[model samples]
Target: MTQTFDPPPPDVVLDPEREASLRTIGVISYALHAVVAIGALLPGVQASIVLLIVAVIVDLVKRDEAVGTWQATHFSWRLRSVLWCGILYVVTIPLWFLFVIPGWIAWCLISIWFLYRIVRGWLAMNDRRPMPR
Candidate 1:
């Protein structure tokens, strides 16, 4: 007669302190992004580039630390959002020199999209859920 063996259980242990720290970092990053996004959407209200830079720096630095955790997706989502927004803005720069109205319109749409991404990500983070890939 042959005997059947059961597979081992997966590791489910987590460090509570580390998780709390990661969540706090996520909140700070989201807050900074929200401020920048709102400022961009508003008329004549310039958001400080310094804040964006700091948020980016925070995401880049702490991202690796959050690997294998749910928070990693948030870091990735924020970074991708910033990268895409910058690319879109640069691609539309010629519109500014060509047609003022169209350029303004393009930037407004992009700003709205950026704000949406920030809000969605922030909400997912608050709910402690991973962002949809």
Candidate 2:
């Protein structure tokens, strides 16, 4: 017998409250990323590290509830995507310490990628079909 796979329906509707929460999280994450990028350009490694720590804290708070909701709703793939993006960003930081300019560029690219994934997943979660890639 042959088996077929079907995409699960969205677990949560995009109400005004959820939309507001998503926008808030997006803004916070973007701001934290911007600060980290700018801090990397400064003289000391301490600034970059401090900014990175702040970013991580912000990330944890922002995603904690969302992760729980996703798990409870069986949207585990979305959670995995978010987690992978975080991991990629973390791995790129030390590289920035080695070769400043190139590392910063790479970091920026990775940051953009993270934002893309977050927005994409958010849309997917809400069952909003994103535009073509």
Candidate 3:
């Protein structure tokens, strides 16, 4: 027996409400990532994981609705940024002592990278531009 496959329908072209809601969520996720990056500096708050969890949940839950829209790019960008930063943190955990000041330097660089992605993506979304892959 032979099986046949059909292409998926093209995405819906216009969705003002979806676009607005997506921009709102993108901004929220951007702020959430910032909070996590900064919260690490505070004395008692271990917010990186907590805030990441929150952002991931929000993004994943709404992702289905944005899949075919321009907003989907923002979701992908946000997830990649978070995933990379998390991996960097994991690397810092074990070699933290060996690297010492260099580790501190690396963490600082990673934090800056995280902030850059958030701000850049947020700005692009505000301008109604699609994120670069």
Candidate 4:
């Protein structure tokens, strides 16, 4: 005997009001990240670090919808990217002490790498692919 498979019913989609709320939350989260990035350029490293930390926490908390899950996973990928960037920063610090140009160049490269990773992760999340093993 052959078995037949039935398709699942469509899920109830959120209304426009709920969709707008979710988008607003996402915008706020992105704005917080922008503030954190800008803080790095200001004087007082300690204060800037604190602001960045707060921004990260706020971003995490604001992500409470379906988009939030994607944002959280993207954030994790970015965190890993930052860890790799940190290793590069450590190795280049001594070089920076000797000559600033090469160190700055390395920093820029690492930053670009981190941004690229984040963008790729975001795109993958939007595509809804299974995480790689």
Report the lDDT tens digits of candidate 4 across residue range 19-80: 56644644454444444443433445322455445645755565445442323444444445
lDDT of 1 by residue, 1-133 (tens): 5533222134534489988999999999999998999999899898998999999999999998877677788998999999999999999999999999999999999989999999999998898787755
Model 3 off-target regions past 4 Å? Answer: 1-11, 41-48
What C-alpha lDDT does candidate 2 achieve relative to the native structure? 0.51
Which candidate order results from sorting by TM-score in descending order?
A: 1, 3, 4, 2
Model 3 root mean square deviation, Cα atoms: 7.1
For each candidate, give its TM-score against the true structure: 0.89, 0.42, 0.81, 0.50
Candidate 1's displacement at residue 76, Å, is: 0.2
Q: For candidate 1, what is the TM-score? A: 0.89
Q: Across residues 7-124, which tens digit of lDDT does each residue of candidate 2 receive? A: 3246744567865675565455545554554444445632455654565565555654544243222133333444675687688788778888877787667656655655554554
Candidate 1 — worst ten consecutive residues by lDDT sum?
3-12
TM-score of 3: 0.81
Candidate 3 least-lDDT 10 residues: 1-10
- Alpha carbon deviation, residue 102, candidate 4 (Å): 1.1
| Candidate lDDT values, in order | 0.87, 0.51, 0.78, 0.51
